[model samples]
Target: MRSLTEEEIISHIPELSNVTLRKITKGYSFDLKYVTEWNGKNVLLRLYDLDLSERVQEKVEKMEAFKKLGVRCQDVYAFGEVPEENFCYTIFSFLEGEDGEAALANLTTEEQCAAGYEAGLDLNHMHELRIEASMKEHMAFIQEKFEKAVERYSRLDQQIPYGRKIIDYVRNNIRLIGESRLVFAHHDFHAGNLIISQKKYAGVIDFNRCGVNTAYSEFDKLELFSSRLSIAFSKGVIQGYFNNRVPELFWKIRSVHMAQLLIYHMNWVTDYFPKDLPQAKDAIQYVWEMYEGFHRTIPKWYEERQA
Candidate 1:
């Protein structure tokens, strides 16, 4: 797709008539994103193909809902289709800060934990917007998803080591999915989507993957991303979300969630991002070691930190 010039953008969205566009090239999202200034403040403009109109609307609604609940996130300034360009767009108040994954290394362990705690608290707040699905319905959906993931993994030419063990673990603990509350989830919550300003979490970004699911399913990314960046921060997120009282059931559910990801996400990377397959494998290995091949529930990083 051709890039949209500033002139073309201003012609369609008159409110941004004087804004200069600078494309953001950091993430894996297929959306065309640009950073610009509007009304004397920095803003982000995300352009999605017209076919994804529904997703854009849903993203805007979710962002508005998160804002109303006091979650630190982008505020939608404007959103609509740019029909002439065959794409739709949303302009948001830009978050000013460094990426949390990159910034956490500069912070003290305590400081990292504090930022994670705040992020966890914000995530907990977002979950307040519960979806009306019953536990039975949620369980059925999870079981179907698990079965599909297992099928896909089975068909893959390249499979991770100990794939059978992971599948067995998920099957054994699948019942725990029924115990979870259905809530709005960020879906991709992790240090990579977080923003850090002056060693504190500024806000979260990239709500494109938001949806409804079992609440504890949200933490799978903590194993894949956050803990690799800062164990203290990952631990803090859990502490903040659960009010410093982590539950045994949480560990059980989290392990099951991680097991599913081992199959599902790896298949995803294989199909859509083959180059990332090695990194994905390493991440899977790390998870296996962290949980000791599902022999344990709580990861050693969280447990040793408490000790």
Candidate 2:
């Protein structure tokens, strides 16, 4: 909620002059400031949460590549940690327009579908990047992340009928999804992270969950969102992404995404779970239902995709 003072802005980026700084985001890990000048040029200053040095560097690189691929994203101007100041900071050109979440309320379902499609194409383009030798190395990190989630899930106190089913789906299908020879993925592709200007797609934000991985991972995330909204809408986004029928590996990818989400939500719901225990109980139940619901559909979904 605090805006950066003019003196603070001048001190942080000494070359930057006569620009006004406004606070934009106060999300979990980063504080975002949009620095604008009288001429309307602007840049974003991101002050990271305490102790996330590695992630900040990695995220910047991902955004850089995405920009080259014609994905609308901010270009990084600078990043570093000030030992004296005790904060790791990054600056990027402020992108135009509001976030997708802000714009979605005004868009028709059809417009949303088109935006989703554009995102899918961008996502697919990123996935098409060839990194043959490094595939295994990159997937190892993804596997490790998922493994930790699985381990965490195993430690949860809640007993849900769908947990074992979700586990089984993951164990059975990981190999198929892993066989992909694609490049990186934006593992957290969702509407909230996308930026829209006018009626067209502009760019995406938040590459924190990004890494070298399969294209299917991106599809999986989109499909899950679609399903949450509406199966028809999900299908529309899928068509935009693939431009054809869903791939054989899609179900496997879906299972993996599901498993990952289940574990993630469980960990999330636990760590910062609200004081309202019943709400937490309902959340747990909802995730369990998602696990059960998706598990039952895998067989038919895979069959349809195969056909």
Candidate 3:
């Protein structure tokens, strides 16, 4: 679909007909974000082609759940399909602050860690908001997913670092993957989607990848992205989430999840973000470097600090 003009957007959503609208171009979520005023109040409008009613419903349901749980996120105002324009739009309050990536650049390492710690607590709360369907159901799901990932990754052509070691490690540690209690994972918890205000965490954004899974899976991505930001931040998140008593079991499973990502991440980047190939490569290298440490589960950065 061709990009809709501001007039077209206003026509579809009458509330925005009289307010100012400026396009938000920060992230790559195909949805169009317009920072605009409505009824003498500023809000962000996210408009995307309405493909499936179920998809839109799921997103709004999760957003609503997050808001109720006291997780710092946008308060969704309205969501419905624009029949004439074939678009679905959701209007929500705009979080007033710089994105965490830019904000972290100006913050001290300790401050960044504080931001990460706050974000981590929020994530733990999100996971606590909902429980998994059933132990049997999740067991079956995790088994099938693990078998498929290993079978496919073992056959794939790309040569990632420690390929055999990771595969063997995954196969040997198969039981650990599904042992952790399942909860709703924000799947993409990182600095990029966070909002920083007054050198502190304001809120989190973008729950598009949210799902029901093991909570530890969230750390896999954070460890990758936070490595580029600050090791202290990454360590702080772990400490804060587990209340400064990090569990050995969490680390064991986190290592497995990160290993699985090495095999599967390329396909993700190729399909959704081809432009991010270089960054993806760097992330993969970072994973390899982390695994190089003597303690297989604990990341190298955290291990270095403890030493």
Candidate 4:
């Protein structure tokens, strides 16, 4: 996670040779983000270890895929390794907007939901890139995760809210989860990674962790992160994705997916992010309340608003 020198970066990305280079603070990943003028416009230069060329190439292709699918994102201009450094860099069209998470807090309930809907529209477009993977493969991966959750559930020092019920729901509904379409998920599609310009979803950022997974799986992160910021936005995500016709089966499948994740959530937060544990715990409780003790399928916000 070391920062590259201005001279080293200039040598690699000549476009930034004369532009003002300023390091941008990062939240989670160790990847370095630099803000500078490219062609007289503010742009972001993201650099990461190029130890695995294939992985880096895959990410480049994924970012490009968004453009083909008509999803607005930090348009990637160039991606390749530097001449003398063991690092790869990507130059992006720095979006002009506020952090989507922060922007949601200032909006009215209706405004927040509209923003969520806009996100869903873009997300639906992003899912258009169909990845070729068998349902069996996804099922196997979920099965492996479920087995690990079961083992961890036994060893958890503190009980998750209604832990046993949620576990049972997962076990009972595991079969339904095996069948899903493979799509490239934003991986981190919550409020944190979105850009809100003038109360609208301007674009998405942080595709470093994007991967091919069941489309329904993307909602899990929203359930964990974005929903904590605003439930109106959370409900909008689902409704807008489905175009106001959310299916009965989607809710069932969503509940099952969330239940499985909740199994290991506490230990994961405490073990990995001890400082954020209290907030994470509160978020989990809010989730518990939202799902009505994991008894209801549709989250309360969406359900109560249903006509």
Candidate 5:
């Protein structure tokens, strides 16, 4: 899709008239985003293809829900579709700060952990907005995804190391899928999606990927992304999420989830995101070593830190 001009934006949202719009090109989402000053405050403008109107509406609702729950995220100022333009738009209060992934490396270990702790607390609040899916329905949804992942992995030309073992481990522990309680999740909560200001987590962004899922499943990105960036911060997220006394069952469920990711995510990246294949492989290896080839539930990073 062609980029939306500044005049077009103003024409669609008259409130943004006379403001300067600077295009933001830092994310993977297909939506066109721009930042500008509106009424003495920075605001974000996102334009989406008309076909994505429903999804855009869902994202806006989730953002509103998170705001009402006191989670640090974007606040919607306006949202609507421009039928003539064949696009939908949303205006949100812009979160100001450096991306957490880049900023964490410059922070002290304690600071990184503290930022992660705050992020975890915010995530806990988000989970309080429960979805109405039954346990049986949720389990079926997870199981179906797992089966599809397994089938996709089976078709891969080159599978990940310990692929069969990971598949077997997940299948053996399949009953754990029923133990999870479904809740609204950020779905892409990771250091990269976080905003850090002065060595602290300022807020989270990109709720476009939010959805209802098992609460423990929400930590998948921590294992796959955050830990690789800062183990201390990753540990802090788990610590704050569980109020510092980690549950044994959490470790068990997390292990199964990570195992499934080793099979499913690897195939996914290989197929659609080949550039991320190496990172995905590295994450798989890290998980295998951390869990001692699935012999343990708690990872060495969290265990050593506790010691």
Candidate 6:
């Protein structure tokens, strides 16, 4: 990640009067800076990679749309393209809240349920936002991604049969999901993205991948978050968002999304993990569980979608 001199960041956004840069982290595509402004407000200045021009634009637009839909997120103070470095960046008001995961660990189940439900409510509102355009409108970008993923998985499946099952699941589902109602969705809505303050939901962050997409894609993420915590937590999240019931088709869409995550994990394990490590076997085992779950539930999912 390129370090933006305090001078460059301050030059781009004039609102930071008497700002002081406090910290910067590495190992990410973007640069994160915690700054203290002259006005006594804490703010975060996010500068994207030069290669992420399109993603930055999409994020800016999607954040505006989500705010219009009443989805809680960091308030954008100012954002636009910076000509000097040819990068897009945004300045946002600092939001202070414990991550939902940390909060979950500290709170009782009842409190966890409440926070999860609140997150769900916000997600529900987000999914209700009408998108005048279809995701296919970005076919040149999305279609090629899937095509390459499928081809890569085919080669990997020859080495580990689990990869084939995941490939098949995604092939069958991504197309069906495209046919779903295109609503604004936070593709990454895990506990990490949620913030809780004063024992209640405060905000959600990281809208970098937010867009008009399938409701199912979003649900899959929620499902994974729920699984990571507890069944009760998951139920709380589902009930909070769907009024105690999520449509079956929601799960079907989730199945496809989960399969995608699994494939990504497989690649990570393959490339990063030692070949004989137990970690590799565990990762593959998880994929099998996801496959079995989807297979057993697809008929019910179809019935729900039909209804």
Tens-digit per-residue lDDT, 153-254, candidate 6 = 566532455566667767766665665666767877777778889888788887766766666567664544444554445556677888877777766666
RMSD of 5: 2.1
Q: After the best TM-score superposition of candidate 5, give how far the Cα of residue 301 lies from its true spot, in angstroms.
A: 1.7
**Per-residue lDDT of candidate 5, residues 51-133 (tens digit):** 88998888899889889999999898988888878888899999888887889989888998899999998888888885787
Q: Each candidate's TM vs. the true structure?
A: 0.95, 0.77, 0.90, 0.89, 0.92, 0.79
lDDT score, candidate 6, position 133: 73
- Minimum summed lDDT over a 10-residue window in model 6 is located at 298-307
> Over the full model, what C-alpha lDDT does candidate 3 score relative to the true structure?
0.77
1 against 3, candidate with superior lDDT: 1
> How well does model 1 score by local distance difference test?
0.87
Candidate 4 TM-score, true structure as reference: 0.89
Candidate 5 residue spans exceeding 4 A from truth: 1-10, 305-307
Model 3 Cα lDDT, one tens digit per residue, 136-249 = 787677768766766765664555656667667766775787778788777788878889999998998887677787778888777778666777677777787887888788
RMSD vs true structure, all candidates? 1.8, 4.7, 2.6, 2.7, 2.1, 5.3
Q: How displaced is residue 81 in candidate 5, in Å?
A: 0.7
lDDT of 5: 0.85
Ranking by lDDT: 1, 5, 4, 3, 6, 2
Clashes of 1: 0
- Backbone clashes, each candidate: 0, 0, 0, 0, 0, 0
Is candidate 2 or 6 superior in TM-score? Answer: 6
Task: List candidate 2 stretches off by more than 4 Å.
Answer: 1-10, 30-39, 49-51, 130-144, 157-161, 223-227, 230-234, 272-292, 295-307
- Writing each residue's lDDT as its tens digit, candidate 1 over 1-307 gives 3576668876787668767889889877888888988889999988888888897898799889889999999999999887778888899999999988789999998999999999999989999874676778778888998898889889898998799999998898899877788887888889889899988999999988877788998888877888988889999899989989988999988888888888988899998888999899999998999999999887787876622
